[model samples]
Target: MTIKIAQISCGTEYSGIQSEIENAAATVGGKMVYPDVSYEEITRAVDDFGFDPVSPQLKLMIARAKALADGHYDADAVFIASCFRCAEGALVRNEVRRYLQEHARLPVVTYSFTERLKAAQLLTRMEALVTIVAKKELLARERQVGLTAGIDSGSSTTKAMILRDNEIIGKSWTPTGEVIGSAQEVLDEALEEAGVKFNDLEGIGVTGYGRFLIGRKLDANLIQEELTTNSKGAVWLADRQRGEATIIDIGGMDNKAITVRDGIPDNFTMGGICAGASGRFLEMVSKRLRVEITELGALADKGDWSKVNMNSYCSVFGIQDLVTSLAAGHTIEDVAAAACHSVAEQVYEQQLQEIDVRRPIIQVGGTSLISGLVTAVGEMVGSEPIVPENSQYIGAAGGALLSSGFLEGQ
Candidate 1:
């Protein structure tokens, strides 16, 4: 039942992303193919997305994704793994993003490099179920539906969830500074809320930037792809009210564009290497403006007509633009809206590049509920993006669902 999966890793020559991916793939007993350079790949991908797929780096990445997809040719199915920069965690990241979006092979493209690293690790550990969370649900009819939990140790947040009967019964989130201690604290809190003992759980799953550190310490299973986790969570929340979703997840250091169809995750995209126009960048700018982190959305709504000149979306250099705009007398609201524009643009482009933007959309993550962002993204995306309740919990919820019997114990 091993499906063929293709992984296209870009800027692999410079960053450790390729090495990490390779190591993960090897561990999972999965095969991979990468182009010597990005150019040979542009021609192979179909022009289906109205994209030329001609950017050398993109072609290189596509070549990798194609390779993974090709591996599935003889298998029952195929999954595509498109990866961006490796974790050199430095300035050269611009080169990677520029190379990726030069001609924009996929209209709405997202690399989510950091998120993918965790995904790669999970793929290596449980490659079979990495992209197949939905697949496992078919087993729900046979296996006993047991209590399962997902301990998510995010860079700035610690979260725990309990999924019983495909319902998220109890969930908790706290800022994370110390990994091991924070994980234990949150887990105990979540279990207490659920009124369940640790022994009641069948398996534990973990994800997020801090996953490797805390996940390894635990003996349970793990799933890769924040994309998968988030998408699944979005579906769960949206389904609670029979609402549809086109999720925009803007975290402290990153951003994502996820399209969910009928309460089921269909496709998604991610931002550049670091968090410019993403969460981290937005937070930094918001802090400099002395604005409360949660109030950014409302501030954007009140922004004046002054268009900002800060074009650099890189979080590192974005400060200069913010300052320059302010020196010119732009109000804080005006400046923040411009930042909102930058991020909203990224999300809009990602979803449109893949599918027609006809479906109802939902925005998740920290920025999902932003006041001004919704209208801005709606106007740009051509449809209002709804922010579902508990949007932040989508990914963890998905992980919890996997442990819940709705999938395997029906």
Candidate 2:
């Protein structure tokens, strides 16, 4: 039972806990190999692996890969450490889990230390992670069953996901026009891609702004709260550890600040649908600036935001501010960056004022795809936000998880 751990950390702020880990490792009959890895080594690996260098947070991930690959820290398991509120820590931890599982063929565990946690709780989580890793062989084997479908019908788009034995087999989405038509279309597309029929689905779940339409039209077996669906989907996809996380879901016309505790909604706040903080606001500004929404993030990144400002109260005024800033000799990039800041401000000041946003913040929805907005939100929150892959389709993913659970129960 003496487990040897090759440990990597995101920072030295929690170095005080090193002794605690040592004590706990000894108690559990394990030893840790925490080599003092350099940033230069991490940067080299990042370049070698072709990871995006612009984001400083990626250093954590690159460093992890480098540590695992290097022959110095040879061990039976890997231990990753980061603060609970550290966005880089959360993202890197999740990525490393997959990497170690596939490439290294080793068990990995992450310890998310928080100042708010009592010593007992912190030790408990660490012990639990170690136990989970130790029991990977037993937990890895899961029962496979029939296919399940989850459909998300939002105000601006519809998405569908097909899950077979808890693995995603197919996913598809389309712009929303008529609710039922869009829902049916995406569902059909996903099913076709998965080579399955509607009748073959053991259970179906639906969620989103227009989820009511789908529930009424399709008679979905499960109709969940949009916030619940968002949190469930985001938590599932991110593979976050136990405890709570903040979710910023920016949809077409609405935005939600959801607090998910143990993969369930603890609390939430919804921003006004007509506010300038939503994706529609971004689209409006992008159109006025004669730039594609996809290009807005890059443009904003290039701009000097030191002198830029924009109205955050209303979309109309926000667009007007963007136009005025451009006419006053400010570059379009500057205006675009300011627009991104304005959206973040609107969410932070107007919507998130009521909710206690705990990190690691998982940002989802189409607007979150904008790199600039993500950066702005991170700056405003004083913490980096974790943007997962295929975030916009999290609602559909959440529904799929719910439907899959339902099928398993049957």
Candidate 3:
């Protein structure tokens, strides 16, 4: 179904990009719907919708007031058209935005007809806004069918997962950049892969370092702590509803240790002092060694990590140690394994201080994809750690599950 955008303006003059905006919306399978309501009609709508006029001077305010008053708009998004040097727009845009944000909750895009307004730029902006609105509308439809999405907007990567009936049908990850854009990218990719529409999702949950930003931008229904979500996710993925387990989640910027007891997150610790145990450290080492991150784990599995002892506690010093080892005739595999061991060792010495090693240990997060790192952590914790599928997406999956009420009251 095509998304419909409500075009609203403050002044009597047209913005002169009506055709361009309409074409751009059409390009993205959307329609531009202009409500031809007069001032009297809007006043009557305010009376009907029961919203008192905030200011009679602000024409845009009246239009939004009327829309809210009537409680009816055929559009999924709202576009504010204004001309340059319009004092009315400047005076009322903020309050108008607040009203729309509070009441309508629909995506709002503004177009200012400045003297330098290029056609290409206008079209691009229109297309982008239309695309965002389309996704929102599609997700609204998906909500009717028991679907939800979770986004883990981590410092390193943005991950998205689509859940239906408490099961993840689609998941995707991309490097985190321009938070809002990446959030959309990951969601779009995941939804497309699942062959689902945006409206299919009943809700959206966000977690991770960038969770707050993405949550606000996406209007997420659930914004959870990474530690809590990861703990819930690890237990869920491991299928361990009862009993204690220690979870090691090493991400790009930080390494987290979550202790789950009887399916509840009891205690958690995050490492911030050193980067040697984090994914960023591994990425740097991989680049220095000219080794692909994906290939490092397999190679490390075969090498003798004990031979290349990495004693550096900091990431900077760790790199120096690795380079020195290479200069001293150590092989790449040995260095890679040593790097993985260094991360595990840091977790044990720093991040895992309060956690019990006697219980089952679950290694998760993007770093868990490295088998050698998983092996190293298992060895340190004295038990073979369980590495669940889509370990990188565990937080997002947990958020999705929480939104679906699958992890509620647990």
Q: Which has the greatest TM-score?
A: 1
TM-score of each: 0.69, 0.64, 0.63
- Segments in model 2 whose C-alpha atoms lie over 4 Å from true places: 1-145
Each prediction's Cα RMSD? 7.4, 14.2, 16.7
Per-residue CA lDDT of candidate 2, range 1-410, in tens?
66676666555345456666666666555677764557787677677655544446456556666667665456666666666566656666556554554466444545566544333333322343343345343222233246878888887788998888767888899989888889999999999999988888887888876776787787787676566667777877777636779899888877878766666553455655356888888888889988899999888878866667787578888877777777789998888888888888888975565456788999988787899999989999999899988888888877777655545445
lDDT of 1 by residue, 1-410 (tens): 33333444445545456666555555655544333423434465533223334345554444443433344223222233333333332222223233333332321223334433643444522343235433534212212246888776665577788866555667788788798788788788888898898888876777676667766787656544566566666656666324345666777665656554444344454544556656666778778899886898889888842488765456667788888889998999898888778766665554344333436676776567677767677778777776777776665665665545433434
Error (Å) of candidate 2 at residue 383 is 1.4
Cα lDDT tens digits, model 3, 124-227, are 33443454454332222211125878899898899999987757788899999988899899999999998998876777878876777888987777776676
Query: Candidate 3: lDDT over CA atoms?
Result: 0.71
lDDT of 3 at 171: 88
Pick the winner on TM-score between candidates 2 and 3. Answer: 2
How far residue 366's Cα lies from its native spot in candidate 2, in Å, is 1.2
What lDDT score goes with residue 30 in model 1?
52
